[model samples]
Target: MSAKRGIELEPDLLDQRIKTLAELGDLTGDLVATASRLAERLPRLGTAPPAVHLALRLREAAGSSGLAGEVEATEREVREYKQMLSEAKRKYEEHESQAREDLRAAEESAATAGPDATGRPGSPRRSS
Candidate 1:
């Protein structure tokens, strides 16, 4: 396939990937928020059973901080990937536009050149 056609067909994959990445980022953000809320409310449950407090302590020890860090890193990666996708799409469109213009100009040149300009073996050259 031609470069222009290839470019036209290529964006679907990137678009789908970008969409999936965005969804993942959103889900990760929600998870982080939910975890933070759970940690906050766990201690404020007001005179819970001793076993419950022990469970809360165990849960805290498992480290929401690490999960937060991972969420942050993943969010940053998602932003970077989105930016890269946007730049790639912009560049592809620029290339496609230039290719189209080049094709149009070539067609015009060929048409204006008339019969003899094709440079065939038996074609006659135009008078200077």
Candidate 2:
């Protein structure tokens, strides 16, 4: 393909990389939020001396068996999000690397194909 076409492909590849990076960033944010909320709630669940005696009553009122299950679920979600973010980031990096390599190759090809000495292809004639 022509250098121009290769350059065009670079932009499209970069766009895809950007999108994947953005998704990874969003997932990371969600994971952080989930971890923070779970951490905050889990600690409060144990540190609330006043709520100790009322735990059973609150559980009945909330209709949930226990906070452990909920905390575990949140932890699992965070873990999954983290894994997804890692994969997205890895893909983005791979695309970025490929784009860079493609761009460099295209540039080299363009330079080599440009005006040579004597304005001829592969000519060894030196310029004035």
TM agreement with the true structure for every prediction: 0.63, 0.42
All candidates: CA RMSD (Å): 4.8, 10.3
lDDT of 2 at 75: 54
- What TM-score does structure 2 among the candidates reach? 0.42
Write down the worst ten-residue block by lDDT for model 2. 60-69
What is the Cα-based lDDT of residue 18 in candidate 1? 77
> Which lDDT tens digits does candidate 1 get at residues 1-119?
67756524477787888788778778877877766666565455446698688767845743466555566677778878877887887788798899999999987897798867666
Model 1: which residue pairs collide? none
* The candidate that achieves the highest lDDT relative to the unseen native structure: 1
Off by over 4 Å in 2: 1-64, 116-128
